[model samples]
Target chain A: MGGEYLANLADSLVTVMDKMAGLTCEWSEKAPQLPAITEGVTVVSLLGFTGAEKGRVVMEMDIETAQKIGEALNQEELGPFDKMIFYALSELSNIFCGAAITQINNGPRRPGLRLTPPNILVGEGLEIFGERAHLETASVFWEGGLIYIHLSLEGGAAL
Target chain B: MIREHLQVFAKASSDVFASLGVQAVHQAPLAPPDSFFSRYDLAIIVGLARDLRGSVVYSMDTETALALAGQMMGGMSLPGLDEMVKSAVCELGNMCAGSSVCNLPGLTADITPPTLITGSKLAIMAGSDNVLMTEIATSFGTVEVRLGLEE
Candidate 1:
């Protein structure tokens, strides 16, 4: 993946947040330090892209943050973290990824990527590990809290 | 048809493990009651797109994971679920998913890179009403394959 591609993704995210949730999100210049053992549960949304270049995009956030942003997107007051919030998060991931991948395809080196439906995982002290090609991480700050976006390409070139 | 597709995936997983010299016996699909949420200590998730659109999640406990990783690393015993072990397990998931697409005959599909998730309590939502699940038994332990695909 190119730096240009990363820029497009970040821009897509910021734009999506503004349009969908009416929230302003900015990418953190410095990588935020996460404690070794986080106190609350984390909700992660995993999605995949395929076509010319295969890749994966993951969105990570605390459950509370997910709840807050999910509520914003739904334009309703949701009590605690529940199934409704999970559905909202899943839809949020789908919309954000669809927009970002669309931008990449329209731009140079368009991969013509297609997306797989997102899966949401909820757990305490969750950690994700795997081999990645050209993995890039961006931490975004919003009114709710900090969320992380991890984008990585896969295949021969990535090696 | 979805059940058949899931069966293809199960056979693909067993075949991949067999190639790695592990005897994995795949059981029949679990009867369902609409959507199901399952939890495990470790899970490898890969998204499928194109002809096959949805996700396949392979979940197991840490002990089963360590044993399988050890087998992948030339049958050496692993002390714990270290980075190498986790990477090996992730690769195994990737291989299983790739093989599944191949076993589906003429379907043109693609699999995303495997994502290994570890947590004290990991809960997975199939996200599909028509969920197909099966358990595969091996000397190492049991690995559950839960597939949720778009109709």
Candidate 2:
């Protein structure tokens, strides 16, 4: 995937989040994708890859921080990263992908972007995709809180 | 306050998506007061408040989302709302909010965490003393959201 395309995708993500989601997140295309640790893995949001390109965007956030947002977002009493918690996440990815499509569709250059729904992987262990793929990510932080955003775009040109 | 917010947001979401070749109607004749998909459906929504309070999102089940995504795909069955699908839908919610965030002045917004919920028995945490559960029946499925706000 071209850097411009990825930058478009990441910028699209920040734009949607800012204009749509009411979040004060900053997307830094300047950073590299965080490596999923093998020793102590955390909860991960694994979304599918599609488009005039192929690959996925994986998000890893500390559970404590998730609970902080969950506290504000959750309506019923329970813990963080619960089964239903994925709903909160699923919707995020859905809208993100939707915005991405909107950009690629409207962009001056035709990149042909396609996307699938996101899945929240609760299990641990280092999971990576596309060995020869180039990595680009945005370090999303809100109020000094940490939420890791990783975009894994692998080989291919179409969905 | 959150309940009213959802209704307002939902209305705005429907309105915006309508312009983008999306017709989001409430579940009435199409789904009904209580649809079969309700039992198997799960919705998770998150909001952002930066330039404005973002629209509250409701991410329901893939079984339900796939039906919608399939249409976005122009008629193609997928194994379910996987990585790309989920994020796309999340982005849909994001777009809807952007479409109308400015209407709610005094706060800018953005969305984060496209977390996925796959299983049943969703126990949401209601920290407030009083929580209102709004049974929002939509064309896709029944959207149950817990609203908590002071003032």
Which candidate wins on TM-score? Answer: 1
| Per-model root-mean-square deviation over C-alphas | 2.4, 12.5
Give candidate 2 regions above 4 Å deviation.
A15-21, A37-41, A75-78, A156-159, B1-151
B1-151: candidate 1 lDDT, tens digit per residue: 7778888988989999999999998875564524334556899998899998898999998888888888888999988877788889999999999999988978988888888888876677654545678888887889989888877
**What DockQ does predicted model 2 obtain?**
0.03
lDDT of 2 at A149: 64
Looking at candidate 2, what is the lDDT of residue A38? 23
True contacts kept of 1: 0.80
Error of 1 at B102 (Å): 0.4
> Which fraction of the native contacts appears in each prediction?
0.80, 0.00
Q: List the global CA lDDT of all models.
A: 0.80, 0.48
Worst 10 residues of 2 chain B by lDDT: B29-38
lDDT of 2 at B48: 42
Interface Cα RMSD for candidate 1?
1.2
Q: lDDT winner among the candidates?
A: 1
iRMS per model, in Å, is: 1.2, 10.8
Residue B112 accuracy (lDDT) in model 1: 83
